[model samples]
Target: MPSEPNTYPGYRFPAEVIHHATWLYHLFRLSLRDIELILAERGVVVSHESIRRWCLRFGTDFAAKLRKRRPKPDDTWHMDEVYLKINGELFYLWRAVDQHGVVLDILVQERRNAAAAKRFFKCRLAGLKYEPRRIVTDGLRSYGVAQREVLPGVQHRTSRYLNNRAENSHRLTRRRERQMQRFKSPEQAQRFLSAHAMIYGHFRPRQHLITADQYRRSRNKAFRTWWQETCVPMLA
Candidate 1:
């Protein structure tokens, strides 16, 4: 039998498997079964059930590691929500982005009302150490209420077209969701999407949807940093 591949420090599964699982979760938006099939094509013998177990066991810890390695978001934040389907039921996924279009955080909830919105702001938004100077969001009154309570003095804008930046950010998440055949539950959606948000924020080129020069430079730097820091192991 071939020798089993090694893993990262204190991890059980091969680091290659964990890395592949993480990439599959974000870039391709594949479920455990889909990831199993994909790896099988590459001659890695693994079961869908095993993939699921690996995700549940190590997914959150891997996400936490990525977050710890990421830089802080810009000072200005834009918030928005996109519709998500879970077990054929509808929900809203609240996402926040900084001025440069870097994703900051995401919250999955059943409602877009004041209560849900308040929880998003109070819980997810509050956790950020880099308190934004200004916040841009849609003309939702819930946002106003949350801002009044949580970020009282911060400048808040509620214009229609002004929030297009955030609205556009939702498209990427929507694309990823479609690939996964939708989430199974709100909890699953939240956990998976949070990891997605971090991965997206890390690798996305600046102004990718627009300018090329900036995109090229930003993408090169982002990938270079990721390769150096993530792919190469640090000395103990």
Candidate 2:
């Protein structure tokens, strides 16, 4: 078999460095500067600027690979929007998650109108490559319109509690945003959150719902599958 092509263009960091950078950014919840400091303590010197670029560039790539290695959720979807700060301005982040609490898609938009809702629906649905049997959302007219226009026949339900799954899904994102202080722009927020969602989806196990031993074993199996199907092939 042919060797997998490298992702870096014209410049390459060691594979170990790439792995460490990806792991620390997600696992330790460290910012780029913190990651730089942590690596420096281990005898690796890298600029924070480079670390930031790596997180933005390679982080997304790694997350994509991780997503491909995971099983797609066939359960119903819950969609919702939450207010977020970007450049001191309030923007909206449209998020969708499956019943299993797996993040399906996230889109950051300036408005919460029908047009914005349609865009979010298109982007999220396209990424998942599946039309869900049911979609639950809050009492938003725009959501109704978007559902009619895009999903058409898909079962659409509007209820306060029906959207709790999606509302709770946003909490992890809010926590990450707080850790970063705040995003400087909408583009930055979109890029970082999109990658963060996939990383969280990969490492997180249902600890509250499952035993610690089960969680550990599940996480290890997930990691091994991810490394084999994503890393060994894509980064070989």
Candidate 3:
């Protein structure tokens, strides 16, 4: 028999199986039952409940590892806040992405006021080693208010049209939100989206900007990084 991964030593399933289910759930947006069906087709019988548990335990840790290994984000940040309908109540999801569309951080909050924006800015900034050179956001007024205090001296550009990089970042998020049938609460939204953004973005290079050959090479490297972070004894 093949060896099980050291990284997942205590689990009944091997790291490969657990990681596969995780990738399917996060990277492919497949539900737990869908992953179960796929695995069963290949003669591995595991319940969706087990897969769900596996994801909850291991997926976020893997993403955090991946996030640490990523190069520092570019200096220009594009930030935005989107309305989330959680539990039939309105909430705000604040997000920041670098010019390359690499997600910086995400925050779920009860409002989009200046205080809420400051909280988001501070939280996002706390994770980074460096501050942004500039930030572009919609003309929310709150962002401007936050910038004066939390991000003083950084070049702030407020325009509805100039923030397409940040706005376009929400497309996948919107899709995932729909698939999950909307988040149940602010905590749930914050916890799941933070992991989901990192995992999904790690695999998805900007394919449109690169040649097909280049895209393949970039993808191969990303998968290698994924394995190095999640698998023990490494994958050749």
Candidate 4:
């Protein structure tokens, strides 16, 4: 992996503090004001608006670093689309996850038709750098239509019950939507959800499949990776 950038020359706060606040915001369901209050308790007097700016500026960089550290996704991809309300306008949020529940890619679009599905499929294929062996979806004919165009030879399964992994992955997004009261625009929703997926996917493991000791080890490793990715080292 490439080395993280060493300096935030113009920023008044240390990179450690800035990145920590960003991590807290995305890793947990905390609002900007909530982060400000938490920092106040720690004797850091930064404003909520600053926290928001830090997230907007550096969230994607942190997420990109985390994505580099992730393992290659599984070949069986599960795809789903959910409707998001922005300014009382309905938009489609398309997401795909691997069998292990790692998010592959996400896109926000105005429709859920074949064109939208094809765009989403192309996005995932380009981002992940390969086609999946099998793609599963919740009986969406658009998925079938798109797959035939973009991934003609890949296996496509359409079933309501087989795509629970992708459906369940939306729980966090739903919580965040409720907390934010709804997104203001399509661009904002896309940016936030893309970064959110990478950060959340980094820390989330299949807890039910692992023993306690293994789970603890996994959690610790995730924290260590987060620290390395986000913090610049102090001078000697």
Candidate 5:
């Protein structure tokens, strides 16, 4: 593929360095200083602050490109919400994933009420551009209310056991939450989680469902897509 246009204009660092640093920060649960130390060992002198800036600036762009390349989500959707403590204030994080474990959308809201549920449904459905065949969730009454208003005709299933896919998706976020000592604000949590989901979704295929060779091919393809999405454009 031909190179893409310069995405980091006027920055002293090359796109490769910036991209690598950003990737490390998101793809792994590493702190900015950890990334700084890793880069320093490789003979590249850079400050943690600079790495933070690069991530804040370019991470969303990379994620948007990755999402643009994803196939439309499956017809069956799983939705769930988890609690988040931001500055000691409790918040709800609503998340939706397809049957294949692909994240459809996420929202950090102040309540887990019917309105919050409706808003999440509206946001996710608007982005997907198509109605799902079935919606699955736990025994949350808010989900029923939202489904009735937004997706009245779609099949709605409520079973905690069946909704494991969506619930399991929160594991990474929980780990990252602990690592970062919890988010300072809802906006920060939303931005970081939104980008994290896309980047994580791109790289994480269904490992248990595929053979070793298939897994390797899938990972390689994901890496190639990442390189094309983040790196190739710079050369243009």
Candidate 6:
């Protein structure tokens, strides 16, 4: 039952300020300067650099807590890879999502070959209690080759048309990429995205499938859960 202030010792700003700034940076296409401006508007003077540091320090911690709270991902995994232009170099971002559109894992790699696919498969499969019932992916020969090698028994359906669930998951990363003027490095992209996917998905509920009131309730619940996980420890 510890509050954020109690836990974050020696920090100048309160836990709320740090958490809010991190939230704004990830949940929107806003830049660090934009976040600083917003906080200043509320009479909370903090530099953009400070906000960035806060995100780098605390974003992953919050995201880990949120991920721990997620239900076990569905058995059907949709996998896809997209090329990301970073520092004039092309890197493929491999992402896997469940049928419910929950991001299961993400990896930034230099190649989109069978070896890269195998690496992603191992990373995503780690810690899961059960192998997926099926995996859906685009018509990539690499995926087929890796599947046969790493997941011989799991059913894999390879089709560009059937993998919308995973392909669409990349939109958020694309939006952030443009806003940030493309990622500076693979390590930076991986760190930010590892936290970004979890935190953003924690707040975003499937609104189109529910009524307005239901959506509102879900939204409220999401925020409440965020506050508990990021700003305070939840009691058992």
Model 1 TM: 0.80
- 199, model 1: CA deviation in Å? 1.6
Q: lDDT tens string, model 1, 10-38?
A: 76667766666666666665667788888
Residue pairs of candidate 2 with colliding backbone atoms: none
Backbone collision count in every prediction? 0, 0, 0, 0, 3, 0
Q: After superposition on all CA atoms, what RMSD does each candidate show versus the true structure?
A: 3.9, 3.8, 1.6, 3.8, 2.9, 2.8
The C-alpha lDDT values of all candidates are 0.75, 0.82, 0.88, 0.90, 0.90, 0.89
User: Top model by TM-score, which number?
Assistant: 3
lDDT tens digits, residue span 1-236, model 2:
96554444544666557666876787666778888988899888889888777777677888888777778786689999999988778999999888877788899999999999999999977866678899999998999999999999899999999789899988888788889898889998888888888886788865787988899898887777656533444333
**Taking the tens digit of each residue's C-alpha lDDT, what string does model 4 give over 1-236?**
96565557788887888988998999999999999999999998999999999999899899989988888888899999999989888999999999977788899999999999999988887755677899999988999999999999999998888899999999888999999998989999999999999988788888998999999999988888888888666333
Query: Relative to the unseen true structure, what is the C-alpha lDDT of residue 163 in candidate 6, on a scale of 0 to 100?
Result: 97
What are the per-residue Cα lDDT tens digits for candidate 6 across 1-236? 95445346768898778888989988988999999999999999999998999999999899988888888887899999999999999999999999888898899999999899999999988877788989999988899898899889999998888899989899889989988999999999999999999988887877777899998898888888998887654435
Q: After superposition, how far is residue 163 of candidate 1 from its true place, in Å?
A: 1.0
TM-score of each: 0.80, 0.87, 0.94, 0.93, 0.93, 0.93
Q: Could you tell me the lDDT of residue 27 within candidate 5?
A: 88
Task: State in Å the error of residue 211, model 3.
Answer: 2.3
Error of 6 at 10 (Å): 2.9
Instruction: Show model 4 residue runs off by greater than 4 Å.
Output: 1-7, 234-236
The RMSD (Cα, Å) of candidate 5 is 2.9
lDDT of 1 at 67: 72
